[model samples]
Target: MENKYQFETERLGFRQWKEEDKIPFAKMNANTKVMKYFPNILSREQSDEFDS
Candidate 1:
């Protein structure tokens, strides 16, 4: 398989977001428990626009 990750460790990997990551990222942004400190849960479009 190709190594698409920017870097990896025994237990972790880091890479820029891919097109496939949007759905999961949006779901995470919409999680109340996970976003307790945020002003509000993000919509899918907002999550899609997230930078950094």
Candidate 2:
């Protein structure tokens, strides 16, 4: 797939979210270490909705 990035740097790029992001995004959202600053961990459904 071609990535049409809105912004880019030498090592990073920003682009629109894809369907493939859901699972991993949910995993990250459920990680206590990752969500330490946030209120709480997200359920898979909540994560999917947040991605939408």
**lDDT by candidate, in order shown:** 0.92, 0.92
| Candidate 1 residue pairs in backbone clash | none
Candidate 2 runs further than 4 Å off: 1-3
Worst 10 residues of 2 by lDDT: 43-52
Question: How big is the positional error of residue 23 in model 2, measured in Å on the Cα after superposition?
Answer: 0.5
Top TM-score prediction, candidate number: 2
Alpha-carbon RMSD, each predicted model: 2.2, 2.3
What ranges in model 1 sit over 4 Å off? 1-3
Which tens-of-lDDT digit does each residue in 1-52 have in candidate 2?
9669989999999988899999999999999999999999999999999756
Q: Could you estimate the TM-score for every candidate?
A: 0.73, 0.77
What count of clashes does model 1 give?
A: 0
